[model samples]
Target: MPLNEEEAVLLGAAWQRLAGGGPEAAAVGAELLDRWNEPHRRYHTLLHLWETLRAVDVLQGEAADADGVRYAVWFHDAVYEGRPGRDEEESAELAARLLELVGEEPARIGEVVRLVGVTATHRPEEWDADGKVVSDADLSVLAGPTDEYLAYTAAIRAEYRHIPDRVFRAGRSRVLRSLLDGPHVFHTAFGRAHWEARARVNMLAELDRLASSAPLDLPPP
Candidate 1:
């Protein structure tokens, strides 16, 4: 879906802040927005980008380089294709190229690339403030209200509609199990305090549903 006027304004302001307000920067932002709106996407759409950005704003003070975190958020899923590791690697590469196009410093571009890579595992070192913030913000959807969380899972199912229900359930259940087995679902202190428990509850409930005999009420592909 095309960005609404409010989303456009907000994203434009954010792009200006991070990329220093140039035509090249604007072009790059437009390109990323286009990718986010691609028809193949269901969950990883512009709406997800907007939500991540908003979550970042809530945890901005926790970032060592807040602008870098924002840049990472913009590019983290810029090339999502349902392939987790390769998608992140390509997205990091995309971030590097576009940030360089907009005359971002080499070091800053490198940081953005690294931050984008961190999203692959969501397992940044405890001392990595920017990584923690980016990971937590990207995952904030997991902690949303019950209805919103169900919608998120349904959208995810839609995205992988090519996979059979049994296969998708097994794979998704494994992913959820790994997350639940982790020390914390969210990395940052704010996330741990505010989002961790709810995210766990949501994931556990989804795991139950996935394991049950009843079919999911997911949107048709």
Candidate 2:
């Protein structure tokens, strides 16, 4: 699908936030692709960004934001690894810098930063708009059908490069099971109403595959 108007504004805002405005398409496109190329970071790649941006659109449905959700997307996985607080801290820092450069209100920028943190690890009992949406966007991939989900898993495995397959499998199975057995894969009505069944089904199939140990049947790494 083509970039929707709200998505465009959000993209423009991220570009403006990042480079202080008036950035050419080539530059931003290159930056987006560059970020995509970082090995093993594929789960949070530009495609994921594009997909989540679209998912958020599906959720919000043509609303423009005084929101920092756009900004949150840009920084949500900014530091997925190595930096424990990168998503929150760097996202906040980027928001602050963007606000300073783009002339947004300092107070709004702070809230945007706070919103980003709220999304870090969603806690159901403590839900808010940003937290809910951010969490939904991040989990949207699970809602995808088979091939895409496998591709996502491969990308995630790539991210943890040093870990051996045996070790990785053990860890991967645990996480997959956690999602499969969870109460809900997505929190919001829009997503739950739409993507939940598909996600759970896919997750269970993958889990079953992981639980098997027939030497002749297990696929090669």
User: Pick by TM-score: which candidate is best?
Assistant: 1
Compute each candidate's TM-score over C-alphas. 0.96, 0.72
Return the lDDT, model 2, position 118: 58
Model 1: lDDT equals 0.92
- Predicted candidate 1 versus true structure: per-residue lDDT over 1-221, tens digit per residue: 34688987887787787787778988998899889889999999988998899999999999999989999999999999999899999999999899899998999999999999999989899889999999999999999999999999999999899899999999999989988999999998899999999999999999999999898767866
Q: Evaluate model 2: give its TM-score.
A: 0.72
Assess candidate 2 and give its lDDT: 0.63
Alpha-carbon lDDT, every model: 0.92, 0.63
Off by over 4 Å in 2: 1-40, 61-66, 82-89, 124-127, 180-182, 213-221
For each candidate in turn, give its C-alpha RMSD to the true structure in angstroms.
Answer: 1.3, 5.3
**How well does candidate 2 score on lDDT at residue 49?**
73
lDDT of 2 by residue, 1-221 (tens): 23467865566565555445454534544454455446546466666777776677676642235246665666566545634456557756655665555565777677667766755554434436656676677788887878878777666766665666677678778777766666876777787899889988887887776667622122223
C-alpha RMSD (angstroms) for model 1: 1.3
In candidate 2, the residue pairs with backbone N, CA or C atoms under 3 Å apart (3 or more residues apart, or in different chains) clash, namely: none
